[model samples]
Target: MASFDVESLFTNVPLHETTELIVNNLNISHLDKFGLDKVHFRKLLGITAHHSVFCFDDCLYTQTDGVAMGPPLGPSYANAFLCHHEQDWLEQCPLEFKPLHYRRYIDDTFLLFKHPSHVNLFLDYLNSKHPSIKFSCEMQKDNQLPFLDTMVTNNNGIFHTTKERLAWEPRLTIGSMREPTPFHEARLVSGANSFGRHCQWVTGLQVLRSQSLRCSHLDFVRNTGKRTIIERHRATRC
Candidate 1:
């Protein structure tokens, strides 16, 4: 198994190139009739400066390639753009090197390769596909590795998971803030149930095989998200 990160994915995506790629890949004649052809799209992007025009510290500039990281549209556009390449890779992967499982969220990707010998070769091939988008890979130590908020372990062909404390979560304290609704606050503790459900769904592992927290630690675990969760909810409401 190998873990790969797309280095500077959002900032590295070439805007004009990605748009052109999307247009060509779509190959929809109706898009041309609707004036959504590559030429028109490029012209529209010029108006938005490929949606990369911005001012920082009172200076104006334009990004030559890549969309702005902060825009809501950037992620969706970037993911769609990468999908083309991902599909090609899947189609072209050698049978012996084909991954047993693959998963991705935004730029983070986890791949379960069938053979260890093919792992580095696969990573090299992926990185060589595009000069701007490069993948950095890690081979798992032991049978366990961390991805997002879950600790994944492969026991032979079976997969299991354990709860992990994401770095983004704050440490627990007695004075954690509360949500206005009981149901909202309860998810901090109960969210583990969701996590368990997600692990089961993703890996088809029995829920009983998952990591279990000590009863005494529930308060600490649940309370960790209290302040941040409330703050996020309040922000969204405002």
Candidate 2:
């Protein structure tokens, strides 16, 4: 078991390239029915993708490098961009070197890549795909791998998970700033996506919240988004 996190993901996506890729990949038949041809759709996407401006720390900044992080379209656009590259990579990747499973939620990726010597090689290949995108990996140590807020242990083909406390979270609690954040703050770190081309994986789940959640929310699991039961079971097919 291992995990890879894209370093500064949103800020590094190539806006023009991704917009072209997305428009090209969209179904032309459906687009035509809506009076949106490939060229027109590409133009619209290009304008929206490039027109991001935000102010932080009282300084106005125009993001000239990549997608802005906070917009509604940021996650979807970045995900589509990644899917394009990943599909192209897997087509030519060697079977032995390929991972048994690959799961990604936005910028964070978790996979079962067993080859010890080839893990670095895989990271090197991913970094080579684009100049701006890079992956930092954590291989399993003592049968444990930390992915985002979850610690996962894979025994045989089964998996178990427990929430992890990040070192930085403690620093955020300083100076008696103990007031609970608004419920909508949860959306800031939201996305659930999993993919396994030909892998049977199992997982357990437990959901914990820092403060009482304001919404009547659905349950969630770490490795797979569906099936909230905390017992070994096959992950839902994507």
lDDT of each: 0.58, 0.60
* Candidate 1: clashing pairs of residues: none
lDDT of 2 by residue, 1-238 (tens): 7777899889888998887767666666656555666786665554455756443443334477598876566876677678778767756667766876777767777777767666777787788888879999989988888776677887877888876766665322112211112222122112111112101121111111212211212334333464332222222211
- Give Cα distance to truth, residue 218, candidate 2, Å: 46
Task: Report each candidate's C-alpha RMSD, comma-separated, in the order given.
Answer: 19.5, 19.4
lDDT for 151 (candidate 2):
79
Which regions of candidate 2 fall more than 4 Å away from where they truly are?
32-34, 56-60, 164-238
Report the lDDT of model 1 for residue 235.
Answer: 38
TM-score of 2: 0.63
Q: What's the C-alpha lDDT at position 217 in model 2?
A: 20
lDDT of 1 at 107: 75
- Model 2: lDDT equals 0.60
